[model samples]
Target: MTTGMEELAARMRDFAQAREWEQFHTPKNLAMALAGEVGELIGEFQWLTPAESSSLDEETFDRVRSELADVTAYLVRLADLLGVDLIEATKAKLEENERRYDANLYRGSARKAPH
Candidate 1:
């Protein structure tokens, strides 16, 4: 069975409600929180080389995973407050990205396709 965005969103809602943090979860505030979480996630990789990044030890990996979950939670909360369907929006955005970045043309290339 797959756990979907709805369940995650519900949990986030309840968690925030329980803490009486709804007022602090405005889209702008959530976005900033999300950014901070992302920054924390990035900091985990700050001095790691590519190989080191790919080979994080268990303890560090767990920290990275938790930071990632925090980012997702804030992002979901922001989307929920803004009346956006995260699942549908993600699917649409993925489709758009696929169209904009053709694998045939972009294969083995790190450079983004010019608009």
Candidate 2:
């Protein structure tokens, strides 16, 4: 069963292949692109207060959405290229986090777990 993210990764693979862009899609390049996209996303919220960030106006929200898509595309493509299953990795990370940051111990706190 192909997950939606898997399908999207396939589509991205095809997109790059069709454009002969794979040569430019090295892991380092993709990671940098993903970081740039995240920076763009952050820019959309840079001047907004927490409340304003949460309640973005339509135009700002759309820009944020587009940046998020860019970030996700690079992430998915990078993971696919490296043979990493994003879904499984995310699940495993979530399980690890559940152990590391027990809700009973960390609820409503912003502090990092003790190392």
Candidate 3:
């Protein structure tokens, strides 16, 4: 069965194909675009306190949602072109993190785990 990420990637592929935008969607270009979108998303929260950031007004929240979608679209497209299985990669990374940062050792600590 196709995963949701795969379906999203397929749709993203079709979108670029339809627009003949693949030429502009090279990995580097996509990575840069993703960074830009992340910057926009960050800007949406830059002035807010932590609590305010979590409780954005409706208009601000909508803009945040749009920026997030932009970031995800670029990420999905980039992963698709590189033949990366995002879900599997995420799972593997989570497993590695679990091993590296045991909850009993790292819980409530903001510092990075020692190498």
TM-score of 1: 0.88
lDDT of 2 by residue, 92-115 (tens): 998988898888888877666555
TM-score on alpha carbons, each prediction: 0.88, 0.93, 0.93
- Candidate 2 backbone collisions, by pair: none
* lDDT, each prediction: 0.90, 0.92, 0.92
Instruction: Sort the candidates on TM-score, descending order.
Output: 3, 2, 1
When 1 and 2 are scored with lDDT, the better candidate is: 2
lDDT value, residue 40 of candidate 1: 99
TM-score for candidate 3, please give it: 0.93
Q: Give the per-residue Cα lDDT of candidate 1 at 79.
A: 91
Worst 10 residues of 2 by lDDT: 106-115
